[model samples]
Target: MQPLPRHWATVRETVAFPNTQEYALTIHGASDLSLEDAQRDAQERMALLIASGGPGQLHDSGLEYYPLRRLPEELLEELRSPGGELIAAISRNRYGSAVLNTDALLISDVDLVEPSPQDRAKPAGGLLSRLFGGGRQAELTPEQQDPDAFGLPGLHRRGEHHERTLHLIEDFRARHPELGVRSYRTRNGFRLLVTGTGAGPSSKRARELMGQLRSDELYMILCRVHDSYRARLTPKPWRIEVDRFEDLGTRTSADETHHAWVARYRAASEDVAVCRLLDVSGPAPSAVEQQIIDLHDRAVRPESGLRLA
Candidate 1:
């Protein structure tokens, strides 16, 4: 009987982003293996990773597996993107050392065994799901929420269930210092944005945080004003009205100033017909913003001087 196929496996997995987790699994047998044996070896290796919780703390929910017979373009792009967010999955073959990166993992260059004539091995289904893992852990459930209800030094402890969130924010800030995160005041409350220089781990973490907040309804209400000037500005003759919340005076006391600004915006949104507040709170537009607006205006309303060049 021929010996089982040889498989090479990675023992080190690293995640360069805040919202990611990494796992490494070992594969056995590489002494004398065939093509089919090699495939089975890779499958078992991925199964170990899957059992460990996929790529990161978050399981790979959208990963798929394919035979190592051919490399697809999409898989190649995911593996090659310089600053891509996708996880780098690595695997190795036992024969000619054909490095393969299925949709969800990358196998670094390694030898792969060639199949001998009449030597046949069956294809294993569910390689992707097995390697990527399955299901999110229940450790983060509400019942298991952090015991420290009050976040930070002086924040209230009553019903404030965001200990994990606060930790994530602090970790992100510490990790990415160059970027500027502005928490602007509005009728609703605060709007936090992660912006700054290079593309690094912090930015990736910030994006993930933003995604989580956006999904929460509490954060949504604190982000918008009802009677904003943008909503009230009735473009005369055009029948278009803009009622954007006007940001008020700047103060040294961040908390007080934010609260005051929320009130002001709320009042403005409520009295759209009577209040004559101007739009002064728009975010300081960057060069990217200007270019985008210019392009959009030119495409939609060429008559307006909103378009440049």
Candidate 2:
């Protein structure tokens, strides 16, 4: 039988000056570029804006950048009236980015594979497949290696690898009966409903049990998050902050232990906004049945959060 087709997942966010006007450039580079490199990219972009606009002055805070502005009349007149045309001639002969930037593409991506049922279960194709592919596959081209080689990450969203993650999670749930998970469909991607069961003398223990379950679930998910993006040459996604949360549990005023968890986890993942509960008996629930319920009185969104440690 022919082997399954390879799957790649790519996501790119247009980098901006945040509070300033947008520029003609974005920052994309090596998968492992460091702090100094990022700042250099910013400086290079500032220079580019000058070229596009011509003879300007610009500045930035260590944290943010300002769009280039034309130098004042006195300075502009001095440079132009005397040697400007000579410099312009030299610049015309130059043959690269009008800007000083070497990193023309600011996008980053994680290479992925679409594994079949057989592949998903194979120890080689499981989590490790996220990193190395089905052990000794054909080498990827240089374009396939560095997303920059292609100029852009992709024209549209690539979510088949996402389906693969869902499959991995299902396999995780099957192998580990101690935990429970459900997928929450969001506008762009999936959030997870995570819960687990454990017995304890006090609600404290129950909360701990729930925490452990969330931790384990996140470990598996994030393992994929980091490991799945296997390309070593191109940049990986800039930020990995929490996108959303599936209602994991709800809490009454009296459910202090659970409520405390809600506050702590929610604060930790302030980006998310939703909550739910699994009868306070999750992962390893005791006698209570695992009937999922809203943590609030009205039909509220699941603001509860996950700790992807």
Candidate 3:
């Protein structure tokens, strides 16, 4: 018997928190402006967003227009802990900002790789002057510095916490062959995907897998993808769903859906083949019977288009 594909409900909701933790809501671009002004803008915007809820609740607004130089040390400490949340530090200095999440949800353990001397030298002269004064220069140890200190741009140091989390996922996949994995790069880090079929033991088995993620040190997280498909027979009346690997949620149907016999080329000489799976249907379809047929068909001609040529 073949397992039926489950329909996952699409959520347009956000994760809820019981309390505001010690995390720093980082806001970028405010480096040019005064910290007080930046904080005021962030607070006002956050209040408004919270009041008018929708997609706003789903996204992290904690870091909007945050002031960096005047950031409090206590907040910095929270940013380093596993439970600490760093809102709105732009990853890769991209156009906008994002939350810097820790694997343990503790922010203090987060460590940024130091920038190169050229990058470090770019800091305002006043900060440089402070580094030279007050005998506080000793606190600026190499190990304690950010990755930008090493002159490597856009390099993030995955503290022990995050590394352990990733390994746990890889380890789980190794133990389970039927499972599929997908990954996507995010502003602060990467997003992981874990998917499989069946119920009973299969669904129950996810708990153990989830435990590994919770206990691991890595800050990355897992999210399930949802999809919908309309039935050709019923048209408006019937629909079905299947879970598939997706890199990011930003793809349009044209970009995500594959066409048979399409050749995608990176360069004039480089060649790559693109193929999409086609649904097989007649007057009636059986999930159990067709699954076997699909398996056999795939085995016989895995590279062929869904339709007969």
| Residue-level lDDT tens digits of model 1 in 177-236 | 654443321111122333333222223442344443332332222112110001111111
Candidate 1 residue 189 C-alpha distance from true site, Å: 6.3
Best by TM-score: 2
Candidates in order: C-alpha RMSD to true structure = 27.6, 25.2, 21.9
Clashes of 1: 27
lDDT digits (tens) for residues 1-309 of candidate 2? 111112111122333454455444433221124545545544565456444442122333222222121111100100111322211000000111011000111111112325567655666555444443556543544323432222235411133344454465455456656655544432222334344433221234433432333324333332232221010110111212322212223212246653554345435433432222212212532211122222111112333432111
Model 3 C-alpha lDDT per residue in residues 89-153, reported as the tens digit of each score = 11110111111211211111112223346645664444343444443443544422333122334
Model 3 residue 307 lDDT score:
18
lDDT of 3: 0.27
Measured by lDDT, the strongest candidate is 2
How many Å off is the CA of 125 in candidate 2? Answer: 17
**Per-prediction TM-score:** 0.20, 0.22, 0.21
What's model 2's TM-score? 0.22
Predictions in order: lDDT: 0.28, 0.29, 0.27
